[model samples]
Target: MNAAETPRRGHCSDFEAPVYRNRWRSLALALTGSLLALVPAAPTAGEIYRCARQDGGAPLYTDTRCDAQAQPVPSRTPPTIAANPAPDLAARHDQRLQREHERRQALDARWLAEHHRAAALDQRIRQAVVEGRVVAGMSAAQVRQAWGAPDQVIPQVGDGAPRERWVYRGDRDGTGTRSVQLEGNRVVGSGRRAPEAPSTPPRTTPPR
Candidate 1:
């Protein structure tokens, strides 16, 4: 109303404006706090490294020491071994063995045929000995036809009825020696000697 009253009113308005400003500041702080709670916080920085440049100027960021260059480490993987892809060697070996077996069988057959022929010839010789009737006073040629060749022939040293001795050794399993006494070229006597024990043991005959 008066000049003095205007000054007092101005001072009161100033005081009220400060109170409103303080309240507005408090509301703004509360709103800022709510916004911060809703947003997610940023993650903290991990370990950092600094690598110096080769020219010795600025340093570069790396995950290793500054003195060493960064390089990928080699993985600890085992070496792979390739498998052998050879052809069927076992089958080929078996086939070769079969061929060998067949060849041996053929050889055995031929040998068996030869052995049978020899056996037949031996049988004929034995039959001839039985038919000839080898007796005393027979010629040496007749005795040979009866008993085949003698194993040994020894001349007589002193005077006697017989002038020579013809010896026939026994077979592998047979015992004793068959001998013929000869007067000149004729057979004077024929006999067998008693067998002595063999130096080596006799072999066992296989069963037929």
Candidate 2:
């Protein structure tokens, strides 16, 4: 056969076929990438914008912004109703008053209960003082047993701790009365007040 009709020795169709197939693969890959870039992405939960035209047509809602004034709108959600017209002023005022009255009643009940308790405690302590049975550094249980109930119990605040001061008098003056101070439900001290020292004039040499 003539050389022109025979296949070349050094050049084979197998090599050319592989190169041609490779070029086709690269072209296919480029086309696929371009198509992916042009495609839109999945829709997000971002707010949709509503645009109004100068001609007063129906508003247009779009994900893309418009040259006109754009207002935000929900994509799939229903429009929300207003907050019930804020309960007319009179109704609001009445509701507020009712709440305030309820709060005040709760406070009053609590305060009255506390006052009654204080009065009862004071009575117990006064009875104990009359009997003269309680002493200093006595536990609450011991005091309750020996001193009896107090005339009244008044809470005291001192030194970042709660204290109880048993202070009262059997007479108009504080004579024959004892003062007791309690902390942590235990009597810390108890005693009568000391008498004040009498004032006296200083001795002076007589003027000659």
Candidate 3:
């Protein structure tokens, strides 16, 4: 073989072929790895705030409320995931709705408790006032226990028999009024009347 051809064949060895191929492959892999590192990471959840009561003080997010003077801080821990992925969306929504339902139930229970207490106090106060007014020929004290106190009372005086008028009002968001009229100390007549709502006063123009 010619001298140049002989040298070329020696240089083109099996070891040389693999070394060149591996060098290019290594460079390609390193470039890909560098690009992946440059990519940004996913975002996370944010903060929340809470307070003891509105107008009580500035709000904050803590298991416990701060002092009246101290403003609330951003003290609550953020949720683990900012949004629900497809697989978890339904479960997350159900959890949120359950929490809402529980919150509503708690609020309703508190409202009902307060309403019951107020109603009991009002009944007691009315009974004291009515008991002092009972007289002969009038409905006995038993009536008072059965029915609430009179909203309107008309005193009576005359021969034959004296008379009294007792009016009972109902609660219907001011839409209706119910009255039970007691005459001569006994329940005589009862009726319901549509409430005459007060007309709204005309608004006056502000002085120029």
Candidate 4:
């Protein structure tokens, strides 16, 4: 061969060597990537066990040969709950509930002191009877005539005598009085043992 052809041939061989090395390196990298992709995900170490019942309602164990006639048991695993910030969440919830309860109590106190629908109705009924709006020895019919109709009528039994109640509801605030006693189509004497107002208030009010 000529000198120039010899030098060209050697250069061509050197370049081809690098190409082969590059191809081998590329093949190895591809194989490594494929192997990594095919690897299975890891699993937890716990095993499952379940029990089956026999004809006599006895339990059969798994991974053991306790009963030959027992059916194969089903596999069971305990449930895994997600992580939670229970302590912090519970504290916040309790605090919110406390605040709400405090607010409700404050509102209830305000209503009881100012409006006091129940107490006011009781007072009005006592005042009416005392001032003769309801006559002392009146019948149920007479009471109805003076105060219109009662809001509720409750029939009662088992007192060894028949009994009934006539409830009068206040028109303005929906509060009222109840008269309960022996009934025979007409009331016998009631309002005799009726509820009384606070005795302290009577004693405290200076005679005027």
Candidate 5:
């Protein structure tokens, strides 16, 4: 063909637009790949055991076994937790807990040292009750704990102390009634008394 009759592609031509855009895209892709290759491959978001689902959502990942397809993907973020505690660290933690327990026990013993005497007295009082005996200075509650409830409770405004007399039923063989005297809720004395005999009614004849 003659030079004047030569066919040439125009800037606005539809085919040239597409070809030019494709060439630029190819150059841009090459540049991007070269830059990516030089940049140390970005640590790959770490390897994981991924279990993909049929629902097309994100896959499940775990440090343990995977139940589904486990193809490693770059999108997975590694778990933050370390697999397990160091053995020495765990042992030290256990020892620290034991030491804390011992320290607390010692503190309790020191703090409640005065109450130890009261506790021992309470134990002795309980032992007295178990032996079926009431002692002087025994509280009303302790006396009840030793013996059962009294059959009669009589309050007296006495000269010494506002005393209360608790009388118990006489023995079945008519031995005697047991009594306890209390001064302000504490036992002062206890004794037995002869049982009162039943009085008989006098016989009378009908009007004959």
Candidate 6:
């Protein structure tokens, strides 16, 4: 070789040495990354925090404490309930209805008894009328029982007995007058009279 070629070859050798060094550095970095991937990561210690929303919204959970509207999470459990409860609503309702039914039954029985008593009293009055037992010595109530009410009752004085005459005047055309006399509450007598004659004098004697 030439004396000048020696220097040029030395410079080429220097450039090629830097390229090999760069390749060796890249290979070392790749091997270090693979080794790191194989090694297990350590577990991090974290605190649980609960964050509140602006309105009624989904709750947020985070490992770090929140600065706005946040609180540490608390443990929660379900509430305990009794196995055997008190009487239910349906049972109480049924009892109330039963009591009302009994009350109505009692009222119905009392009304029926009163109705029977009135009917029996009416029957006794009819029997007295049929037997013609409404007479002197019978009470005024007994007279009323047989004849119901009279059309007129007139009081009399200046007589043998303080008396009241009850008159039943038939409808017009002068049919007649049926009268019952009572001294106090006792019936003294009862009779019917012919219609008055315009020319005849009134009778002073009580009817027999």
| Candidate lDDT (C-alpha), each | 0.75, 0.72, 0.62, 0.62, 0.79, 0.76
Best by the TM-score measure: 5
Residue 71 alpha-carbon offset, candidate 6, angstroms? 8.3
Candidates in order, TM-scores: namely 0.30, 0.29, 0.25, 0.24, 0.34, 0.32
Q: Model 1 lDDT vs. the true structure?
A: 0.75
Collision count for each candidate, in order: 0, 15, 3, 0, 0, 0
Per-residue lDDT tens digits for candidate 2, residues 43-70, read: 3458677778779999887776564445
Report per-prediction Cα RMSD to one decimal. Answer: 23.7, 20.9, 32.0, 23.3, 21.1, 18.7
Roughly what TM-score does model 1 have, to 2 decimal places? 0.30
Q: What is the lDDT of residue 135 in candidate 4?
A: 36
Candidate 5 local distance difference test against the native: 0.79
The candidate with the higher TM-score, 3 or 5, is: 5
lDDT of 1 by residue, 1-208 (tens): 8885575544557558889889999999999999999875442344346556899987786544443344423334689999888889899999999999999999999999999987886575456567854576567887888878989999887675558898889833577888888897877788877898669988999999
lDDT by residue (tens digit), candidate 5, 1-208: 8976665654455556888889999999999999888764322345656676789999787554453334554564667976785579888999999999999999999879858977877788788899977777789999898878999999998786679999888654657888889998888898877867789999999997
Report lDDT (Cα) of residue 130, candidate 1.
78
The residue-by-residue lDDT of candidate 6 on 53-134, one tens digit each, is 7886997887655664455576466798878877788988999999999999999999999899878866765677677446
Write down the worst ten-residue block by lDDT for model 2.
168-177
Which pairs, if any, clash in model 5?
none
Candidate 3 CA-lDDT value? 0.62
